[model samples]
Every structure is written in structure tokens, then in C-alpha cells.
Target: HASFFHGGPNGSMGFKAIVNLLGIENYFGKTEYNNDADFDGTWGIWDEPFFKFFANKLSSFREPFFSAIFSVSSHHPFKIPEKYTGKFKKGPLPVLECIGYTDYALRQFFEKTKKTSWFKNTLFVITADHATVCYHPEYLNPWGEVAIPILFYAPGDSSIAGVKQAVVSQIDIMPSILSYLHYSKPYFAFGESVFDKNRKNFSVTFTGNYRWIENDYLLLFDGKKSSGLYQYKTDRLFNNNLVSKNPGQVASMEKTLKAYIQQYNNRLIQNRLTPFSDLNYKKSQTKNP
Candidate 1:
């Protein structure tokens, strides 16, 4: 069974659509906006107490269940609860204090769950859907602009505790989780398993044009031809362009990126994202070029 917990009014709209499409149970905190004292008067409920409320509801689920919870108190306007007004220090950005409040809320939720029966066996994966405003120069480029944290936590397992020095995208999370669980089923996914160290994984982002990253280099491709190439590992600012110098690398990366674009658009338009639907098909039969 799968369940989703949404912490705000409008936030639930998108999540509810996904949960309904997947035919799963969902808890929208907006329903409690009228009576709950935790409401921030702007957003729905404050994450501090709402997380505790989420914990109570999560306890009702049976074993072998999948759950997703979203926190909204860290959003815009960035207001904490009345009692926690001066609790968190305000940094250069207004969102910092709000993040601190949500951190406290997550701590409370974890404390409550630690004593629960399923705590030991649960694998918690934390991530953000996208990156937001940047205050630092390091995140000014295309790769850094879309980069968000993806963390895996298993409280009872010491083997899962290590810093991974690999580039991975959010699309890789499902395959990584399945790999960790030793799942042996054949599946179709655009991303590779992060647990497989030998596998070469890359990520693509489109901000007007396509930016693809593999190993240490970042290649920028406009719809027609290759525009720029940079070794992002050494040149964090992306000031130098290697397209004129490295013709072979440009040709290789552009070909790969075009194949990715073709596969993504064709699969999405034709509704053949699954392996079952893609069987007995050839690349020549694809609609998108």
C-alpha cells in the first residue's frame, strides 16, 4: 500500500492528482485548516505540529507500506509559529529560519517514529523536487542551478552510511532503492542505479536549451547544434568553451543528447514508458526524430 501526506492547501492539489492516478490513499492537511490551531494564517498548517499530526496518521498504516510526506512551512513568506518567533536565527536569506523550523519539525517527527514498531526496518529517502533561489556564486551555472540534495537514511543498518562521490539525479532514486532491496525484476527507466559503481550515469537539464553532464564535462546543446562545452569539475563558472578545441567529444556528446531527446519525447507522446508497451518496437518506428 502507498500513502501521501500533504501539509498545505494548494500543495495537496498536485500531490493528490498523483496519488489518485496511482490509486493510493492520501491525507490532505487542508481539511484541518478550519479547526486546527497550527494554521499559519497564510499557508495551511505549520509543519512543527502538522508533522506530529502526520506521525499519528502514519501509525495506522500496516507493514510493508510506502509513504510520502511534504513539508510546507519552509516556503515563501517564511514565517515560523508564534511561539518560535525568535527561536531560529535569521540569516542573509529569509528562507533560512523557515528551513530551521522545518528541521525542528522533522526532528520531532523522527523522535516520535523511533519508538514505533516499523522504525528499524524503514528506509527513508529525502529529496526536493527542484532547486530554488541561489545566494551563492557557486550555484549560478546550469548544473548547480538544478542540483538538489538526495539523501538515503536507514537507521538500523550501518552498511548504508557513507558519502557517495557520484553524480545522480532524482530519476535514479527508484532504481537505486530497488537495487538496495535486491529486486530482480526487469524494468524500464531513463536512469541507472546509483548503487552500481561501474555504471556510467548522467543527468540532463533544459533551461531554454539542453545541458548534459557526464563524468567531469558539461555539454550544452541548442535544438540544432552544439553550442558550448565546459569541464565543470575544474571550471565551476563555465567560462571556457571547449567546443572548438574538442571536436570528437562534441560530436559524441551531441549524438547521445539527441538520442535522449528523441527517446524521451517519443515515449512520452506515444505513451510507451513501460517495458511491456515497448516490446517488439524498433527505433526507426519512433515518431520523434
Candidate 2:
């Protein structure tokens, strides 16, 4: 089973049969808005709760099942519940509001799950779909950017906790799971398992402005033009110019970025885009991209 936050790009309360099929909002909760473009600002939705509730279902089932809960909660125009306004520090980044809300909900959920039997036998994985989109102008780095942080938490006879700063992505989830089960490769998964020793220890981001990660440095591109390079190791905020200082570093990184782009675009051309279930995608999403 899969669910996502409401209000995504093809979500429109099931309007046109064609528009309704996009399945963009298939995993999310809907907002209370007349027009799809408007933000109704409802929180406590399909994001973290979707994960919590589905995990509950996973716990109850006698048969083995695959459940995925993707969140749109931490994405976006950052409209959160009004009750949290001034309850937490909201002045810095708008993403803070959504993150705060999601985090609290998730922590409570984690505690509840830990006390359950499923927490003992089941392999639990918690990770992010992507990073927060930074649109704030005063933000030290690039104006439009998002961060994706992947965390792996597996239950054992005793609690095991581990944290790493190494780069990871959502694509790595299934492969990691398959490997843990000692299963063979999945047919459509493009990512190498995060556990692979030979796997390159870097990250990649695909936006209109594409990015590549090699060690500590990052290179961004937008198809025809090369954007700039920065080191996440030193410039944590992504503010500063390293493109002039490092020419060779940019060359190798750009090649890696292009290879990923080609692979992604090729898949896009080949795969059929599947629409959502009746209530999923078109119930409500932003009409425009």
C-alpha cells in the first residue's frame, strides 16, 4: 500500500478523466481549497501519519506485505497548522514549520511503534523523500534548493543505532531492503544498494538545475549551461564560488551528472506513466507545474 500528502501537481478533486489519471497526488492528503492552485493550509495529513498508520497495518497482518508511505508534508509553500505558528521558532526558514510538525508527529509515532511487537521482528526503515526546498532569499546558499537525508533504522535483539554523514537517496531504499532479505535484484530499481561496498559514496540531485556529488564537492547544471560548483564539506550553506578555483573537479563531476541525466531521461522515455487510484491523484493538487 502507498499514500502521499495531499495537494500535488495533478490533483484536482477528480475533475477531467485525463487530468485525474496523473496520480501526482495519489499518495498525499487533499487540502480544503476551491481552486487547486490555492493553499488551504491543513496540516496533520498523509505525510507522517500515513507512515505511522500503515506501519500499524503492517504490524497487524499475518501475511508479508510491502508498505510505503511517502510524505509531501515537508515539501513546499510551507503552510502549516496555525496552532504551531509562534509555538516553535518559525522566523528563520518556512520549511521549519513543516519539518517541526512532521518531526513531532514522527517522534511520537516512533515511540509508539517501539513498544509494539512488530518493532522486534520487523525491519524498519525511515528516510526522507527529499530535502526541504529553500526559497528564502536570505538563505546563505542557492535560492532554490532542497536537501534529501536518508536514515536507516533496523530493529535487532537489542536496539542498534547508527548515523552517517555519507550521501544517500530515496532510490537506494528498495535495493537495501532486497539485499537485507538476501533477495536478488529488483527489475526496475535503478539505484545501487546503499550497503554495497563498491557503491560510490556520493549523492545526486535532479532538478531543473541538475547536481552531482563527488566526495565533498557539488556541481550543478541546467542542460545547456554549467551553473557552478561548491563543496558541501566546507560551505555547508552552499554560499561561495569554487568553480574558478577548481576546474578539474568540475569536469569529472559534470560527466557523472550527465550520465545520471541520460539514464533518468532514458527511463522516462521508456516507462509508461501510471495514473492513480480514483481517490489518490486527482482529489486535489496544484493545477499547474
Candidate 3:
């Protein structure tokens, strides 16, 4: 499979390293970065034309190809093209207009892509790397800090529609797509398929402290111990600390979180990220036996 990546920082060390790892043909917005018209003055190229450029490049790619674009127009020091300055509605946050511009850019990209033959078969997954500034009062807590949009859309697939009532993270995206494609090979992933109704889905996030969300409860772990526990579904404000009140819940969640961390750290340290690795085999044997 061929992969394409666009958008990165000045040095692009991190992005280039990932592209190299994926064995993808390296592509970046170096030309746009150098051009004044394409640059948003704050971020690199404006999302509108950059997305169009990416969409045009997609047509040249062969079948069974993976492409990713990281947009930059809807970020800090939010600025949109002069022509669209008064177009989007203004909200409490300055980023809202920028977001609206980015949405428009994405829509334009889709419009161009719809003309392509491969657009119908492709699964489009949209998500952000992280959530930024929060304006709503309910989202002032830890859970809200990590809560970002995750959406999957296929051209005519009704089965992929509707909201799923489960705690899912970006990590689950890979497994879920593989499951939908009926990929039978055993793989090493830190997440489970969201389509597996029998499985308990959860999202773990770290922002200085670790937060583990399962069912309705959100457990806050500070490495040493579970510091705070809140029924996030009900306690949207996270005003109540149920740490002392829920010992059993704390212990169970903490145990799982610790084990997950151990596995993650060990794999990374040992350079054994694949299922075929000896570390994974040993770990699986010990767990199963």
C-alpha cells in the first residue's frame, strides 16, 4: 500500500520520521511554506487550497493507498483568507471562525474528491490530535480536556452510521477499520474494535496525570494511585470525588491501567511493538497460561 503525508513543522523531523517508518513517499508543504500567498501568515498554507492540492494528488495514487493531511488553518492566532473574513459566524471563542473556515475547506476538498472514482469506496476518518481551548463550563475538567471529535464516514454505507454508545479513543480507529475490512491476522494494538459489542471499550488519556474512562466512570490516576473518580456521564462538572467511596472500582481500574502502562512501556523499551515479537509471545503465554 502507498501512503502520502502533507503538512509538518519547519524541521519536520517528527513528521518525516513517521513518513519514513510508514515507507511512504515523503511529501510536505515546503513549497507552500515558501510562498506568501499560500501561507496563512500564522500557520503554513491555508487549508482551502492545501486540501484542494491534496485531493488533486489523491487522483494520481494507485489502488489500496493510504493518505493523511494535517490541517493548520484552524489553530492559534486564528486567521482566515481576507475574502472569507466576514463569511463565518463569530462565536465566544476566536477559534470558531477559524474552525468554520477549516470546515469549508474540508467541504471543498470533499466536493473535488466526489468526482473521483475511488471516493465512494474510501473510508474517511476525521479527528483532531488534541482538544484546544474550552469555552463551555461543563468541559472545564480532565475528561473534557481530552474529549475531541472522532468521526467515520463512508459514501453510502448505512451500517457505519449513527452514534455509538461506547467510550472509544483514536487508538481504536485502526482495529475498528480492520474489523470492518475483515482483517483476520492477529495484530498487536493497545485498543479493541468498537464494532465488538461484547468487548468493553475505553479511552485512556494522559495530560500530566492519567485518565481512564470506562462505562460511565472516569478514573484519574497520578502514577502513584487513583487520585479522583467521577461518574463522568452524570457528573459532567466532576464536582464529586468518589475515590474513597469506591474502593473496588478504583482497584479494578487501577490494576488494568497499570498493566496496560507496563505492557506499553516494556514494548517500547524492548523495541517489540509487533505481535510476532518474543516479548509479546511470552506476555500472551503468561496471560493465557
Candidate 4:
């Protein structure tokens, strides 16, 4: 895993903390950190060099592996490299240009990796940590502000190529990956499998208050009660509060959201995330067993 920040094998927060808690810190062959003085500084390192470093580490590994690379060039203070200044299209926000540069760098990385032995077997999941500056009014609402792309690409197979119209959240990625690997085990997750056609897609977020989206309806809760409801499909701006107009829908979605919040909160407080009492549980257990 190539992390642009949070240096060392075990950082206080982020991915390292989770890995350490799960006792899988030693499982990873290489864990690259950009905060090392050798990289100059976190802001100084660009996408190209970082990706090149990642490619080198990936090529060195002999067995199947899982890796994650987080790019920092497109982050705040969004400075474009002097040599590639005019290479990208400029937009309202400076981050747009930075995004273009990152996109180009990603393409180059993929082009280089395609020739490697590990390229064909890789499953690439691309997503943003958060949404950036909004340019259009349509994307200025709560839903639009939180909207970010989640894409799944399998180089070895084209069977899952088509776009899924159903909404999926970041939490769903882990279950989806496990499902794709045909992992046979009982696990607890707040997210449902994205590949399950019968499952309803939903997402939950908290800014100043809790916001839950299910189907076309969005419900806003103020910890104590649901304050607002909107049908995002019809009212993109969320200008009209449909709490009174759609009582049944509001009640149903509110109940579901409250239940989700209760489950999530209780799980977090109880430290019940792991399926096994010990971290060394075998993955060989059959589905029915």
C-alpha cells in the first residue's frame, strides 16, 4: 500500500490503525509512505513519481497481493507541475486542473502496468475520498455535494463491464470485493453486496446532521427526529421539503434510517466488527460451516 501521508508501519489513525488492529500489519510486503524526508515533503511529491514507485514495488512482489495508492497532488493547494502547466484543461476551481493532471498520470501508470504479469489479474476500484468544489447549481445540494464516483474495473474479465444504475456507497466496496473473490465466511458489515440485484442501494452521511438516501428519497435527521425529506429525483436542489406531502414514504425511510444509525452506533461502541474472536481465524471455512 502506497500512502501519501500517515508515515511509518503503524500510524495513529487511518488505514494503518485498522490493519494494525486486525493484526495483518506484517501480511503486507511493502508499505510506502510519502511523509519520509527522502520524498522531500508530502506536497512536493507528484503523482508520476509516486506511481512509478508503486509500480516498482508491485513488480517486485511474486505472489498475489492487494495494494492501495492514494494520490496527493490533486489535494489542497492544487499546484500543477511547471512542465505540464498547459497540458490540462482549466476550470472554475483550480482542483479541476489538478484532477486532469492526476488523470493523465493514472493513464500513464495503467499503460506501463498493462505489460506486467500482474496487470491482467488486477481488479481496480477507483473512487474519491471526498467531493471537491462544485461548479454547477445542480451539484450544490447536500446529495450533490457528497456525490463522488465509484467505479469497478476488472482487467482480466469483461463480464462486469456494464454500468449499474443502482447507488452504491464506499462501505459497500469491501463486501463487493469479498463477493467477487467468492469468499465463503460469515461477516458483519453495514453495507450490502452491490452485485446483489435484489438488494436496495442506500448511503448514509453526516455533516451537521445525519442524512440518509434510499431509492429516490432523502431524509435528514437531527439526532432526535427527522427534520426534512426530499425526493431528489424530482427536486435536485432539494428546495421543496416533502415531509408533509409524503407522510408514508417519510415514515418508512425514517424508520429504516433510524434502525441503520442504531446498528452502526451500537456496533462501533461494542467493538463487534470482526467475525471471529481471534484475528487468526482460517479463511478455509466452508460457506455452510
Candidate number with greatest lDDT: 3
* Model 3, span 115-169: residue lDDT tens: 9999989989999989988789899998889998889898868788888888988
Off by over 4 Å in 2: 1-52, 71-98, 133-139, 142-144, 157-160, 185-188, 237-240, 270-289
Q: Tell me the TM-score of each prediction against the true structure.
A: 0.89, 0.66, 0.92, 0.86
What lDDT tens digits, residue by residue, belong to model 1 across residues 1-289?
Answer: 6877776774445777777876876545567434466677777788877788777777877878888877788878888988988989888899989988988998999999999998889889988878867787777987788888889999989888888877788889889888988989777888888879786868888889998888877888988988899888788887889989999998988888899999999988876787766763545356545
Worst 10 residues of 4 by lDDT: 1-10
Candidate 4 runs further than 4 Å off: 1-15, 24-44, 277-289
Count of clashing pairs, candidate 4: 0
The CA lDDT of each predicted structure is: 0.81, 0.59, 0.83, 0.74
Cα lDDT tens digits, model 4, 142-195, are 889789999998899989798887768888998998888888998867887788
For residue 278, give model 1's deviation from the true position in Å.
Answer: 3.1
Worst 10 residues of 2 by lDDT: 272-281
Considering summed lDDT, which 10 consecutive residues are worst modelled in model 3?
Answer: 4-13
Candidate 1 Cα outliers beyond 4 Å, as residue runs: 10-13, 32-35, 279-289
* lDDT against true structure, model 1: 0.81
TM-score of 4: 0.86
**How should the candidates be ordered by TM-score, best one leading?**
3, 1, 4, 2
Structure candidate 1, residue pairs in collision = none
